[model samples]
Target: MVENAASATGPSIATRIGKLDLPAPTLMGSGCYGSGEEYAPFVDLAGIGGIVLKSVTRFPRLGNAPPRLVATPSGLLNAIGLQNPGIDAYLENDVAKFAERPCAVIGSVAGFSVDDYAYVTERLAARDEIDAIELNISCPNVGSEGETFACDPGLAEQATRAARRVTAKTLIVKLSPNVTDIAAIARVVEAAGADALAVVNTVRGMAIDVETAKPRLGNTTGGLSGAAIRPIAVLAVWEVARAVKIPIVGQGGIENARDALEFILAGASAVSIGTGNFTDPRAPQTVADGLRSYLAERRIASLRDVVGKANPGFAGVR
Candidate 1:
């Protein structure tokens, strides 16, 4: 999405991706701040483009057992299992709060089947405050030999098309880095009607307890997210960005503005703050402000001017 050189009097940080527009590229990653209610007291939510709520399943999930999270050298290893209140409870209890949000609200939905995904999107689309739908298709599909939908192109397309048919709101399909070829999955989802692609979800990894030689995580395996996965995430974003025309929200281990900028350079139109939130609740604001400073120091007025300019051999990605 790179374009002509920036002018000092160009547009502000306000930007657009597909059907949604935002104040800036900064966004809260899913399951981090939980609808921005917790971070609202700390950071100015109005400055961020949107907040991706916790992943919601059709039914309530108890999530993984205790010891579900562990700290690694770079980030956290978590097997939270998409724990959350059932969709019905969320609509009755939390959906209304989105109306009070100062920025766009992106609802994150996780499902085991195409129907399950569609049903959640169907209900969430009814809410006027939900500006977009981010399908967390990283969960295992019951009908697909327990393989995660994000890891399979066919499953990913099915999941995307189901939700796309149910909602006209901006549809973002979150891809998993666990795949052998991320661009393949990204392309198929775009063909299935995804408005944007949240390139690169968490990478799979595990840690073991030294004392007992047992796995640290209760599930024995968990997704690794943080500075460690940032490189991989950037690579995934770059590959998918080059392969697809749809906008991409680059994420994974973005601890600061520098990290987010790396994603932008890799062709991400927007960036999401995840594990960084746990360390600093105001990470989103810090990133947003820092990004502006970066733009100002370079005399670039529009955020789009710098997008994808870092991809080697690609003079520009207009």
Candidate 2:
């Protein structure tokens, strides 16, 4: 097995996400492990570098109807419409438990309006438990203006700036892949004071039940995630990373350490495992282990050495 060169005797995996220096290059993305309740049994939460909680809305959400998830070729599709127990409940019940973990706790906040965003961000900011906040403005299946806000650069900037006003904690704006130009949107968010960018949320897609001649998911359209979207996610990360100087958290179909390394080579400062987690509960650990092996094999000293290495070749394309 390839070992991480850095693992033997190199710089620490702990790197800066905006001003906050994290413990490792691996961080759990929003909506991956649900609350700490489910993940604690499978792995030591303290051993991981960080955990981004499930998306919390200003009010409680019912999510979508049944048949919400269906497995595709190398991924899955889901239209889980921001289902959560609301911010107040989350803070009172879930946040405290995760805060006690060894790694940093990043809260993922979502809202339909600027006020909602501000309110949720303000609540999370007041807490010492939350290490950062990831603003979810790109959910395509939501009824509100989330999709619009993410698509329009001006709206994306306005929303991000509004959230930045309330929170002193690190703020990361998750971008949508449906936009015409992702780099343009990235620039807007960066200028609006976003600390980091999570490139390319799941691409919008739909599957049909051929026999019944009906949509497979109750919600007509769902977000696509898994190994299938890895190349697209990699391209998106490369573009956004080059457009903005801030840190990029690249995710999409990362099934193994090599896949994670591909994102690093494509310009991600760190990687998040989404659908892969469902297939292998220990997916993140495997990816982390694989990354270490890859680094050792390549004689690379640090994750920093590989980040944005793919940018130079893509300069002409952009």
Candidate 3:
């Protein structure tokens, strides 16, 4: 049944991740989108579904040294080291500002241990302005320990369970692509109580300077994002979608609607835009507009109709 009688108005782009509902399916990826305010001047925040604020840890971090970003042929490598003002300062100074955002405000929590996730999530999700929480267990740029939770199934389950115990708000667990069996990890996370999963964070990669025979980034290794990781992310979403019942926020190298559609077809309920913002801050609008156009052209009743349409093994909830 067409929920909206106006079929000509185009298919509904609205989507749900756990208890949270979004008018648009396009979300600005965490870390890439800075608090939804910085890009407000260049793009309409209302045009997108939500903004995943940069990850905040229990303590302040100075971030990595200079040369944090390196543009490759099809992608960019970055090692920013999760710089933030710590939970105390963020709650006191920054959480209040999110109240003005036109779209859903999703807070991101990064930590060194399970306790850190619980502490930050309890405080951040307690804020009325925050619509949801994203547990960033797959930050590859913060050194070896940074991605430990995401790569290790036990730690991933423990961290996710810890955060789940603190809040009833939607929790999206970010998984690492560097792992050997991502779907297995996804299953464990889902069982541990993640409402939704951010399928496949940046692929681990590094670039070196030939002349100096040294690593280009100060951290030596960085997470790669952009067109380079789309296939990896898509496959991860496909496999994880088949292995779990929770919604999947497909991301990686999504730059346009077609790129996002690939994930939706592979069983992702929604898509996230990160490096694409760097290519063009208006990328979110372009994707949102393009998705509506695609639906209108196909006469699809809603974007949900196409979720997992291409993947036979998809197991996500409608």
**Candidate models: Cα lDDT each:** 0.83, 0.81, 0.91
- For residues 1-318, write the lDDT of model 1, one tens digit per residue: 222122224446666777887778877889777878888788877767888888898999888787878999988888877888989999999898789988888999998888999999999878987889999997432223324788888889999999999999899888888888998898799899999988777788889989999998887888888899999999999898878888889999998889999999888999999899888887887887788888889888778888888876323332
Best by TM-score: 3
Output the TM-score of candidate 3.
Answer: 0.97
Model 1 gets an lDDT of: 0.83
Error of 2 at 192 (Å): 0.2
| Model 2 local distance difference test score | 0.81
TM-score of each: 0.92, 0.93, 0.97
Candidate 3: global Cα-lDDT?
A: 0.91
Question: Clash pairs of candidate 3?
Answer: none
Clashes of 2: 10
| Residue-level lDDT tens digits of model 3 in 246-299 | 999999899899999999999999999999999999899888888889998998
Clashing pairs in 2: 2-293, 3-292, 3-293, 3-296, 4-292, 4-293, 4-296, 5-295, 5-296, 226-253
- Provide the lDDT at 281 for model 2: 78
Model 1: which residue pairs collide? 226-253
